[model samples]
Each structure stands twice: as structure tokens, then as C-alpha cells.
Target: MEGRKLFAGARLRNLRQAENLTQRQFAERLGISTSYVNQLENNQRPLSAGVILALVDGFGVDIARFAADDGDRIVNDLHEALSDPIFAERRPSRQDLKIAITNTPDFAHAFLTLQRAYQAAKDRMASLDDALQHEQIDALPLPYEEVRDFFNYANNYIDWLDRGAEALATEIGLEGGNHLKLGTERLRGTHGMSVVFERGTMDPDIYRIHDPGAGRLLVNADAPRATQSFQIWQQIALAEEHDAIERILDEARFRSREARSIARIGLANYFAGAAMLPYGRFLSAARGLRHDIELLAERFGASLEQVAHRLSTLQRPGARGVPFFFLRVDRAGTITKRHSATRLQFARFGGACPLWGVHQAFERPGEIVRQLAETPDGERYISIARTITKRGTGFRAPIRRYAIALGCPVAHAPETVYSDGLAIDRAEDYDLIGSSCRICERRRCPQRSVPPIHGQISVDARVRRVVPFEIS
Candidate 1:
């Protein structure tokens, strides 16, 4: 592989054009003839080590631009898209797919977009069919999903809001510990807002509520310390950063008023998290502690879920932390929250892979379960999951239980404490995971709920397997 030559003609051409260099000018800089440069740019000739070094030294081009081609990503996405049963017979070969992606990237993207729309439409039709049986049809573009997609496309980080929150934290003297007290003080002093905790005053289900007319913010008396502090910061964000929040909302152009309103709340929650864990200090602490969630939660007075969510938002340019995927699931295996900075994407309409450690975390609450997982696409990740329980006040009160999972690519596993005793190289220790049963291609999985789309199933009367039928 090392001796193999690299041919990235399109990328080389794009880079040269970006730098406003012509074939003659580029050739002079790289100590090559114009014809040779043209040949390389046209991919008639493969890129050599000398040319790569010359490009790096002469033009300061990022080496990764050539090393990690977007064509590969396009190919992977295309392969995944084509895996649907609809195209089972017409699926292109790997080399053919690579050629399509490399030669016609725009057409490839258009095809991917069409496939996504088809999938979305299929999902909606299935829901509609179900609704016909139940006689209930829900609205399109669900508010929660809309907000989730908004954050997903933004990579779970809003630079402006993050920086503003950090500045506000500093102004409120939230540094050097005691963030909850500082948050409370800021809400009271800066916003002229009073924090009130009273049992049975507000809705029993509502955690926090603000009454602008009364100039008071009421929180549930039984709320945890982290929840109380988060509510305080949320209030501050709505009061002090209302203009900024609205500005982003305007730019977002959300389709519905409900979505805009929900997004505003989500943005405020983002601000609260950022304020509670100031970006600079939190990143420093995370690196120093090797991203120990428990230690960070204890040090920052945050919940494990909060720490995990914050870890996924460390996509700040030039000071980025490890790209992590974060997810939260309830006891019934419903994914409550999800964001991935890595290549992994959660199921858009169904439960996650049963083989995932997050599902198992419910069996052993308070314990961090780690697993090396490989997706169907051959990407390996190091995942860690733990159950988070929120206790209720009264004897008969309902308690909230959720499990949060955080993971990054296997290449980053060495930097985290969870990987200390694990053998990442052992295939037996690695769990084979996927997005969902319907989309997963593992034919022999015992836990599969449904046969994969387009899969052929055969049943033999004499054979009894874990699954009733064999899938091919």
C-alpha cells in the first residue's frame, strides 16, 4: 500500500485553482515542467513522493487534502445508500462506485440526496399506514427531530453561542469552582430575576418555568443540584442572550413556529451547558483527566449526561477535542438524544443496535461499560456507556432512568481512561454493531428483530437456529 501511487487529479486541480496558480506557475513552484503538471492534474500520471513534498513545502498545502480524499467518503456513503433492498440487484461494483464518486462527485451527492428522500418517504408512508390502522396521523417534521437535525448539521457546536456563554461565565465569576452559586448570583444580580423553589407551586412535570411578569423563575423543589444550576443558566441565556438567540433563529429559518420555539429552548440549554463548563477550562480539564466523565462531572458539578453531551460539542476549530458520538436512551430502548461528531449515524426512525453497550448499560446501573465496536462499514469505535438515574421525591413518585453513551474512533481510544485494560485488537472482544435491524446486514445476528430490507430468507424444518430463518 505504501508503494502504491496516489492519483488525486481533481483535488490537485482544485487546490491549484484555490491558490490562483496556473499550470505554468504551479509547475515553476514545484520544480516541474508545465506538461508534467498538466498530466498529473489530469491524473494521466500518479502523484509521486517528490511532488507531494514539493506541494507541501512550496504551497503549504495541507497534506491531508490529498491523503484523505473525499472520494472515499462519497464511495462509502454511496455504498451504504445502495445497500437498500430496492437496489439489491442493480448494486454497482466497488471499483465502479469509486469511479462514479471520483469522476462525478456532484451526481454522486445528488444520488445520495435522492436516496435519503426515498428513505424518508418510505418511513413516512410506513407511519401513515400505521396511522391508518390507529386512525391518527401526526404532523410532519416533528419538532424534536427538526431540532436534532439542526444540531446534527451544525456538528453540535455553535461557536458564537459557545464563546458568548464562556464570556458570560467569566463576567458572572463562575470560575474557580462553585458554578451553581455563581449561576444563581448572575440570574439574580444581572437579570433582576429571583430564583424560587417551591413544591406544588408549578406543574409537577415541569422542571423550570419563568414568569416575566413576576420577574421570577420557579424551579421544581425536588430537582437535582445539576438541574437547578442548569435552570439558572438557562434563565440567564433567555434574558441576557435573547437577541443573539433570536438572531440565530432568524438565520435558521425554521419551518414552523413550534420548531423555532423548541430550537430556542435547545439553544438556551446549549448555552447553559457551555456556561457550566467553560470551553477553555473544560477542554483543559478533559485532556488532563484523559476525558474521565465521572471526574469531570465531580469537578464541574455537572451530571454525567451533561458531561457526555459537552464532550460531543468540542468541535472548536484549531483546539478540537476528540470527535465523539453521544447518545442517550431510555429503559424501553428509545433514543432520547443523539449527536455524532464521528462517521457513525444513529437510526433515524428506529432503536439502536442491540449489540451496543448502551443497551446493556441498563442492566448494570452506575457502572461504565466499555466495548470496542465495529460497524457494518468496517469502522471501529471505542464506546463507553453508563446509566443515569434521577430519583423522585415521594414514595410513589416515578423515577427517571436513562443511559448515556459516549464514543470515539478506535484511533482515539488510547487517549481515554476507559481503554486502559481493554484489548482493542482482539476481534472476539469487539461487538458487531449497526444502526438498526432493518438496515443492518448481519445475517446471523441472534438479536435481529426483522430481516434486512431486500434480504432473502430461507427456512428449513430440520434446522433450528437462534433466529427462526436464515437471511442471505
Candidate 2:
């Protein structure tokens, strides 16, 4: 069999642009004709072995990665996006999608971005309509959603903030030490902020309160040790890494001030987690422990949620860990927190598929529920979910509960402790799950709350199945 031809026009053009060279200049450096370079950049010709060698030798491009198309994800996202009811009349075939992505990847990406923006706007409008029945209000982008997209597009890893937090952690000896005490000392000595633990009757919902004017920080004594430590580190982030966080926000270009403000809190929280876990040490420990959440939490003095979230952010350039997606959902199936470093994206608007193990986690609280899940796109993942409860200070106070899930591609399953004794190779063992009901194409899902938006359903009087109608 002959080797597959590599038409990496986008990659080739990007590589040339990165070197600040024109097509002619790039061709000259590669010892190729300008016409040939043009043809290659325009996808009119495939990259030859000689050209690949020249790229490796001259531009230091990894041929394996440079020649790779990364279009599978784009295709999957396009399929989901086109599955919207708006495109019900005309859906492209899988082959058509592959050709589109391969030929015009940038356009494909822009389309996906537009689809996301449209979905976000639709959700926001619906929310505003629900809240204001008679009043005329302008529907604007939701701050939380904007911030979520920011982190999601960034692959849940803010490199500058992560590195800065890691350096600060190292400077302050946060690893293998009393993190809370160290963080408190750092706050007091560096920022001249007084730390006060309120043992008295504080608000049940309040965990940490900071008074910049008074230069004092108040913490609830009844809160967990992990919460206390995290809050302290968050303060340190605001105090020390304010410039770095501001730089990130400036580049992010949030639509509204509310989004920017929310992102500030999110970046602070990210810094706290990064500082507490400190990328290198956490990654090493996680690998050593086979990515065990409980053991890693214990080792880092972090909570399960923190550890799981940190695991998703381990997407450093060279030294990367297993790409995992972390998610948190409330009892009502609302996604409170989500970040995916993998291709398995969560539904942006509607909640995840009810069949997901994360939803089942609520049934068996405290017990880790493991699942081998396959998405509609045929990607398999090993998901582990457990319910977490945040208790109020008193018995009469309210308690907040949520289920958090962390998972990666099944290829990385062996690196996780949750995969023990599992049927990794059994195709029948994998549960079929979809991104959402609106985008899911599965016709036989018994738990489907609604029909797929893009398809026509026939409701015959005499026909009854697991679903109410047949999808066409």
C-alpha cells in the first residue's frame, strides 16, 4: 500500500508566517521553487518527503505533528453544531465535513466559534425573557459563559498564570508544608494583610471575606481545612499575581465588565489551585499514584474538586499529563463547573446526558462510580464521579451538594486507579452517551427527554417503542 499524502496547507503556511518569511523566502530556505511552495501552501500539492525533511532541518518542525491534521475534533464539533434545528433541512455528510476541514480549517474553526456564540446568545435571551416578563431588556452575553469559553478555548490551562503560581509556590515553600499557615504568613508578611478566623456566629454561606481597605481577611472557622487553605492562596493570588491576572484579562477582551470581573475571581481561583498543587510536583505525584484523586488530594492538602480541576489544567507545552475533563453538576443536573482538556466536550447549554455516571453519582453518594463511556462520535472515556457535600456551619443552615466527574480517553485508562478490574476491551461494556439531547443523534436512547432538534420524527398511532416517535 502506498503512504497517505499529507496536504497540510494550513500548517505549512503557519510555519512560514511564524518565521516572518514570505512564500518566496520560505521556499528559498527550503530549497524549493516558489510555485511549488505556493502549490503546497494552497493544498494543491502534498508535502513530499524531501520537503518534510527540509522543514525539520530548517524550521525545526516536528514532521509527525506538522503533517498531522487535528481535524477530527473540528469535524466532530461541526457535526454537533450542524445538528442544531436551524440546519435541519441540510446536514453535510461525514465525507463533506472531512473535506471542508481539511481544505479550510480556519473557516471551519470560525464556524464553530460562531455556533458557540449563537448558542450562548440563545440561552441568554431565553434567560432574560424568563426573568423580565413585561420589561424590555437588551440580551447580553453572560459573564460566566464568556469566562467558561475563555478557559475552554485555552484548553483550561493558563500557562503564564500557572508558571507564575508555580514559581511563587516554590519561593514560599508551599510543597509538603502547612499550606494554610504558609499562605497566611505570606499574606501577612508580603501583603501586610491580617488574617482572622471567626469562631463566632458567621453567615452560613460565607466562607472567606476580604476587606482591602481594612487590610484584613476573615475566614470562617467552621469551614474545612482545605477550604481555608484555598481561600488563603486565593488571597495571595489577588495580592501577588494581580498584574499577571490583569494581563491575561486584557488579552482576553471580555465583552462586558461583569465578565472581566468574574474572570478575575476565576483566575484567582485558578492561581490558588495551581499554587497549591504546583504543576511539576503535582504532575509527578499524580503519575506516581496512577492519577488517584484521593491520594493526590491528601498529598497536596487540596480537596477532591481542587485536585480534579488541577488535573485538567496540566496541559503544559512539553511536559503534559493525561488530558482529562473535569465537571461538576448540581442535583438539578445543571453544570456548575466544567473544563475539558480532551476532545470530549460537555454540552454548553443543556446539561449532559442523563445516562452519564456523573448523574448516577447522586444516587450513591460518597462512593466513586466508574464508567466506560462512548460518545456519539465513537470516542471512549473512563469516567469516575463522586458526590461532594459542602455543609453549613450549623444543622439548621443549608447544605450544598454536587457531583464532580473527572475522566480522560480510554487510552489513558490504565494510568488511572479507577480503571482497575474494568473490561477495557469489551465493546458491550461501554455505555453510549451523547453531548446533549438537542445534538444527540441516537434514536434508541430510552432516557432521552427530548427529540433531536435536527431530525423529523414520525408519530404513528399504532407504533410504540422506547421512544414516542421514529426519527428520520
Candidate 3:
């Protein structure tokens, strides 16, 4: 930072545009001349320390994040898109990509959007028989992807909902009380919704059924107490904080009604998680416990997945947590849920990397597996993975299986209990991993499923190696 000049003109300009401020207005707010702002926005001059501090003070920007490489994901996505066979003959150079992103990031985003649509179309084409049989050929983005991207861009923290849930937690005296009892009491008192546990009478697939007409909430008596408490809190969210959730939905402006509805449930779930583990108390406990997930889960009466997901959402403005990334992957390697407050970005189009410890968690269930991993960009992280098994009520009932991973950058590893005896300074101990096989730039990896799409390769019939071809 002392000698390295950061030309973040595109980011600065995008920030100004988002705030709807003109160059003169932005300059005045920063106590700088319009010409200087112009030069900075145009990349004619690098951002000075004074300018950076001024921007931070005036706009409440996170100085640490402001200088971060926010466009790294965009650049990576662009590389993946350009690797398509259609662009094989005219792919832009890596330096050209950096310049384009620095000068015109919006165009890069638009190109990525188009490329995603094209890829979706190609995938649909591959299933032409099913598409024709079901008459379901459509190029619109998947609702799940749209919602996932929305949460990703929002940094997985919805301020209004979080505050509302925190307030509700305090109001209901959940700090030291049993969450299930308190939540049920609040539902009955505030919404006139009495809880009734239906043992064998409840439908197997339905965890909870809200009966507005009867003023009753029928919950599966056999479900885990934590899950029942979660359902109760979810109802509280819809009943108590409906307006806040709706306001966020209105602002999100999802492309389809299905996406909006899915997002609606997602927001409710978020509220449930936040309310169950209120922010201030949770953050204090996390720091005091050095972020011991097992201990935190036991204290909060939350499942491992819930605790991990809640930990990732502790991104309040002045009271940030360890900046962990939470991810869930199914047995077949599909990423079902992902959110990263750290620099590592999950692959956009596929499963977690085959080499990632999250995938290995499936092989060893019920145990925490820790790994020191380095991405292709040289950033190292300390991740812990474990399998989450959802048991069915009956022996014949279907069981659900998944694995979850939570991690943070190596710089913050000292603050986590999981990093107790790990060799943090040993570079050779870190396992080199990547976002996805198709976009990974690593030249050699025994676990690679496919060659990097953006690199040249040499294949020889007489050659035998870990992989069929050598990447150049």
C-alpha cells in the first residue's frame, strides 16, 4: 500500500454513480477539486491516501474493502466466458481484460449476463428431448441462481431484516431464555397463534402447518427441537417483520414472480436465523469463544449448518465478525448454498472444486475436517468441513445428506478456535485448490476433472501422465 498505486477508477466511478453524485458534487464532498476527481475517475491519476481517506469519511466506505480487488470475480467470469469455443479464435489477453474491467466494468457485467444466458440456452439444448417432451424450453435465468446472485451482491446481510430480528430477540427476552419456549410464547401472545404438536397425525413432508382460521400452528412433534424453534421464529418473522421483509423484496425487484416468492421464504428464513441467534449477543459470544462452532451451536441450540450460516451473516457495519464463508454441497457435488464474506468466490456455474475439503466431508461423516487451502490467486484460507445429516422421522422415511464448510482468510485464522494447532506459516502445508476445473488456471492438479478452458494444451499419444494433456 505504501508504493503500490491503486487505479480503482472504475470502482470509484461506479460508487459515485450509485450515489447519483456528479463529479463536482463528489469532489466537493471529498474536499477535492473537480479536476482531481476527473483524473482519478479516468485513471489518469492513482488514488492518493488523502483521497482514499476523504472517500471513506464522506461516504462511509470500508477503507479496507475499498482498495480490494472487487473486480476479481468479474475478471474470472470474463475469462470463463471468453474460453467458450465461440471466442477461441479471438479471445482477449489477460492484460486487456484487466484494462477493460478497470475502465468499463458495467460492460463486463453485461457481457457476463449475456454469456450466462447463452450457456443456459446451450444446457437446455442438450436436454432437447426433455424440453420437447415437457414443452419447457426457456432461456430465462433460473430463479435459484437469480436469488443466489441477489444475496451474493448484497453481501448476504440484509440490514433492515437483521435489525428487526435483533430487536425482536431483545423484545422477546431470548438472550437467556429457552428459544423454543420464548418463541412459542411470543407467537401465542402477539399473534394469537397457539402451538399444537401433532405426533403421528401430521403429514410427513410438512414440518409445520399454520392454520390462520383456527389460530393454531401445528408442528411435527417428532422434529428436532431446534428445527421446531426455527419454524416458530420464522412465523414470528412473517407476523412481526412482514413490512421490513416486503420492503426488501420491493427493492430487490426480482425478474420473476417465482424468484420473488423464493426470496420471500429466504428472507423469512434469514430472519429466523438472526432472531434465534441475535447479533450483538452472538458476536460477543463468538469472539469470546474464539469462534468455536461446536460450543456456539450447543449454547444457541442451533444445528451446525444454522450456526455456520448465521456466523457468515455477522457483517454489521461497525460490529463485523471473522468474515467467514459458508457453503453447503450435496453428495453429487452440487453447491446448494453459498455465501462468502471473504475474498474467495465460489464457482458460478458448477459444483465446488473436486479438491475442496467440502467434497471430502461426504466420505467422513460426523467429523470436522480442517484444511489449509490456497486458491490460484495465492490467497490462503483455513476451512473446516463436516457432514450434516437430516434424519427422517421413521426408518422408511427418506434421509437427506449434505456437507457444510465454513472458513476465513489465513490472516484472521488466529482468532478462530479451529486454527489452534495448524501450521499457519508453512506455505507448503496449504493444499492448492481452485473455484472450478473449467476456469482454474493451475497447470498441474491430480484431481482436475477437465483441462482449464482458457489455456493451451498439448496432447500426445505416447505420453502418459496424471492428466491426458499438459497445460501451457
For model 2, the stretches where C-alpha displacement exceeds 4 angstroms are 1-78, 92-139
User: Whole-model Cα lDDT per candidate?
Assistant: 0.82, 0.86, 0.85
Return the TM-score for each candidate structure.
0.77, 0.83, 0.85
Ranking by TM-score: 3, 2, 1
Report the number of the highest-TM-score candidate. Answer: 3
| lDDT of model number 3 | 0.85
Give per-residue CA lDDT, model 3, range 104-220, as digits (tens). 976886787677788888877786756677675566667888888777766788777888788878876885349889888998888999999889777667789999999999998
lDDT of 2 by residue, 106-186 (tens): 798678767777876676677786766666443545678778877776778877788889998898788745888998899
Give the alpha carbon lDDT tens digit for every residue of 289-383 in model 1: 99999999999989889999999999875578998999999988999999888888887667888899999999898999998999988899999
Which scores better on lDDT, 1 or 2?
A: 2
Q: After superposition, how far is residue 82 of candidate 1 from its true place, in Å?
A: 5.8
Worst 10-residue lDDT window for candidate 3 reads: 63-72
- List pairs with backbone clashes in candidate 1: none
Q: Which is the better candidate, 1 or 3, if ranked by TM-score?
A: 3
Predict model 2's lDDT versus the native: 0.86
How far does residue 89 in candidate 1 sit from its true spot (Å)?
A: 5.4
Q: How displaced is residue 399 in candidate 2, in Å? A: 0.2
